[model samples]
Target: MASNRPAPEAPFIPAQRETETFGYGDHRTDEGPWEEWNPTEDSVRPVRGRHRVAKQRGGLARSSTVLGVGVIAAVGAGGMASAHTGKPPVSLSMPDLPSVGSLFDDSSASDAARATTPTLSKVGVTSADSDRSGNAGEALRNRIMAQAEQQQSKADSKATAAALADAEKQSAAAAAKAQKEAAAKAAAAKEKAEAAAKKKAEEERLAALAKEYKLPVVSYTITGTFGQPGSMWSSGYHTGLDFAAPTGTLIKAIHSGTITQAGWAGAYGYRTVLTLDDGTELWFCHQSSIGVSVGQKVSTGDVIGRVGATGNVTGPHLHLEVHPNGQATGIDPAPWLRDKGLNP
Candidate 1:
């Protein structure tokens, strides 16, 4: 019926159908009136177009992964730059495809330049540290020297004290010795003075005694002694000492005494007797003349009589006799007079 309308277009379909993709192989085995199907030149045109489209999609996905890794490296480089410059991290971004080569190349050149350059310190203190160390050493030396000086001073002080003590001891000993010597000298001088005083006293006593006593007669010759035998007396021995002298020789009294008898006796003619305070009687027999009276007091060296041969005598002489207690017997008058401090 020759419809006057345009024909409908065919719906588009993919060249690789779903059924064809799921099948295991492209070759089929069936008894049919068909030859082995081979790819035609016209049929290969669609397959080439599909392969090109797949290659484009795969390349776009791999490029996106590479861009993400590049963005991470850019962020790390920015953090490192912030640390070195002491600033905040710069905002990081993925570089445009056209500018990636130029941006990464410039960042590498800056890192190499930083590695070559040397850093400098702004506030310098090297000289100050050196000076401080030297001062510390000097201080230590000074302290050591001070300690040594203190020890030496202590030793010197001890030595001085010892020397002073020794000197004091010596001085004390010397003083003691001097005192002892002085005492000895004083004692010797006192002893000498005592001896001199004793000698002087003895001389004074002797001088006084010499003035108190005297001898009985000046000079006389002894002829007949007491106890002489030769028919000289009636008693068969001479009874007294005979002082032979010239007639009228002065006869002195021997000591202070009283006259008891002044008369002539029988054999002793013109005799005189003198009695002392102690009752001793001195008889003067053979006297030429008698001058003292009876009961008369006479002193020593006084004239008592004159020497002569008046009694029964041979020649002129003075016969002296000593009788204790006025007894008839008598002792030698020479020793009796000598006992009274008279050497006669």
Candidate 2:
């Protein structure tokens, strides 16, 4: 059997037509006015204002747009990148201030801060470990200084201890010296006491020996004491007993004695000395005149002198002194006078 089918339509329409038109002032031409005539379906194509072209990607144009987009994306990513690797975006945030600017001008503060300014580290640069290390260094320095001071203090304490020890030694020595001195003083005082006791015993023996003698001067009133302190005599104290009596009074011999010294002495004026047979001497002083002469043989009851105020005499008085032998010292006449039955 036969089929009346022309050849099948091709995959693409082969016929293509391009037309151009000119317009002026609202005038137009229609399809009936033929400038050139040819009739063929193959030659004419449907007039195309809107055509459904086969949508195919353009390689050059698509590549160009892709490169441009790639450039723009790269720029945007670069602008939004983080300042630090782990930080937020740099371009998306405000910039931070420099840390050193915080304390750049410290002179605006007080003097205490200024004194410590050199020790301060730059702002934001110091780490915790660095601060700790700095503190440790300071502590070490302080410890060194403190140790030095301790050593010095120990040395000073030792010196002071030595001084105190020396002082104690000196004090001990002084105490020993004082103790020795006190012992010496006690011994001296004991010796003095013994001497005074011996002298008192000797005086008692002499008083017993004087019991046999009689008083030489008679009818006399004792005016001055034997040891009265006065300047009338050369010595400060009176050397003999004073007897107040009338002038031209009969002077008697104390014992049977010979006249030994009879002269005008200075303080004891017109003195007469009589030596007894027992080697005792008696001085009769401040006489008006002496009846005896030196080496004159006289006995008891013989007149030796008259009582009067002679040379260096404050009154009419006789200074009588008894001496054992020709010695210069005179004994206390009161006891001897008492043995003679007279109170002086």
Candidate 3:
């Protein structure tokens, strides 16, 4: 098919140089005809490398081939530097090299070489795994600390509870002890008060009893005592006390009693017998005149008769006798009368 685009030109191929030349200026070949040097515009092609413009028709082809070979060599050297080092090509400083600017200007080739090279990270840098491990260790440490705190708190609470319980127990015991002491003290005081009151009541009763009792006689002269040896009675002794007094002298009863007999006896004269509440009898013999009748009640110091020589007496005198339980025998009335707060 017919197209509008231009056809590609053919590549130039160079023939080998037969002999080598080593001089700077032009020289003649060994067999070709001599040609004169010309400086006219039409004769001189641009001098490049080892090739020259020839007069024959194929001269352009030979020079083009040499140029192509030089270009291919430069491109290969630039590619190798870029591929191995991933940088600009080595340039001429002390050693000769291609220009660094020209090599770096190929941005697309530099990028391709960089992509093919193995990538590396900086040395001695941190990573995600190490960070995670550090975080886990810190968390574990915090958990351990928290658990220790909880255990310490529990121990403190137990100690406090035990101390409180002991305090309460001690307080209760102290309270009970105080109460018991108070009760004991109160009981002792009450007992002491009762004893004092009982003693006071006894004193009052004894004082009242002392006020009620009296002596038997006021003023009496004892002439003869009981159990005295005298020739005054048939028993050959004085059986009773003799109160010597004038005739018609008032004679009083010894104590409160009932008059059981008040009449004349056989041997002498009138006699009066008084019986007390406890069955004791008092005989007032030798009374001249009897003032009380039989079956009469009399008090202490009441007039019962008058003193007279009525019984077997020497003169006008009163003979007093006492009998316990109204028996025939008699005791001395002196001590009996003194027992009731009397000295006589």
Candidate 4:
């Protein structure tokens, strides 16, 4: 009957099918005749004898695991970026796929680039620790150099001090030697001057003695010499030398002379006088006998009289007197005899 009822609906049944994904050699099952086939639980399966399960109720477990991993990676990247001062990361995803974190890359380096980084020691300084290490090494080097310089300076100073001391020593020695030589020279010169003065004095004395008159006294025993002090004389000293002898001793002329007087005089008894060529006079008193008379010439060794007791005498003596220029003056008989190379 073309009844007004709607066309009958086909009987409905769900095919026994399992959704799956394929990877590598894994694929879905395609078996039996496709035209007449009805899919049954026994008819369909994975080709690798595997089929997808419910995917843990819409794959929530896997999705949760992936989401957790991404969150951790993003946190790590954010922390690194904070320290590095680089750009922020972005998330990339394929169509109908889960997203993944893509971190920013350093611009200075590429995927193929390699770097040769320097060590902190060679880089001189970077962090606080490296800066301290570098500074310590530099300070040590500078101290070593300074110590070396100081040692060298000290050595130089010592050498200069030694040189100065040596120079001073040499100069002192030279000056001492010069002074010694000068002293020796002065001594020699003084000795030479003294010798010359003595020689001149001796020559003058000899000349005066040669120009003097000869002795006038005759041979007699000399009792008193010239320059003898006498209390009986009017002068302080005796002017004539006294000769005490026997009354008969020969009286000889002391030098070449001429008889001046032979007579008795007051205070001079029995006197014989002689005169020299230089006007010198010799008196021989107390003569026992007068051999030569007045105005008689006599040589130096001629007999003039004999010894006798003269005036103002205690015994027989020939009083011999010498006078320069017959002036009633007398000189020393010792010196007069020494001038003729004879000792009185």
Task: Judging by lDDT against the true structure, name the best candidate.
Answer: 1
Scored by TM-score, the top model is 4
Q: How many residue pairs clash in each candidate?
A: 0, 0, 0, 0
Q: For each candidate, what TM-score against the reference?
A: 0.40, 0.37, 0.39, 0.40
State the lDDT of candidate 4 residue by residue for 182-277, as single tens digits: 999999899988889987876677555534433434354678878889787668777777777677888878777799999887566789888988
Cα lDDT tens digits for candidate 2, 308-330: 88878878888888787778888
Candidate 1 residue 325 C-alpha distance from true site, Å = 1.5
What does the lDDT read for residue 147 in candidate 3?
Answer: 100
Q: Write the per-residue lDDT of candidate 1 for residues 99-129, one digit (tens) a residue.
A: 2222223477646654543322211223544
Task: Give the TM-score ranking, best first.
Answer: 4, 1, 3, 2
Candidate 3 TM-score over all chains jointly: 0.39
Candidate 2 local lDDT, residue 140:
86
Candidate 1, run of 10 with poorest lDDT: 27-36
Model 4 earns a TM-score of 0.40
Pairs of residues clashing in candidate 3 = none
Assess candidate 4 and give its lDDT: 0.62
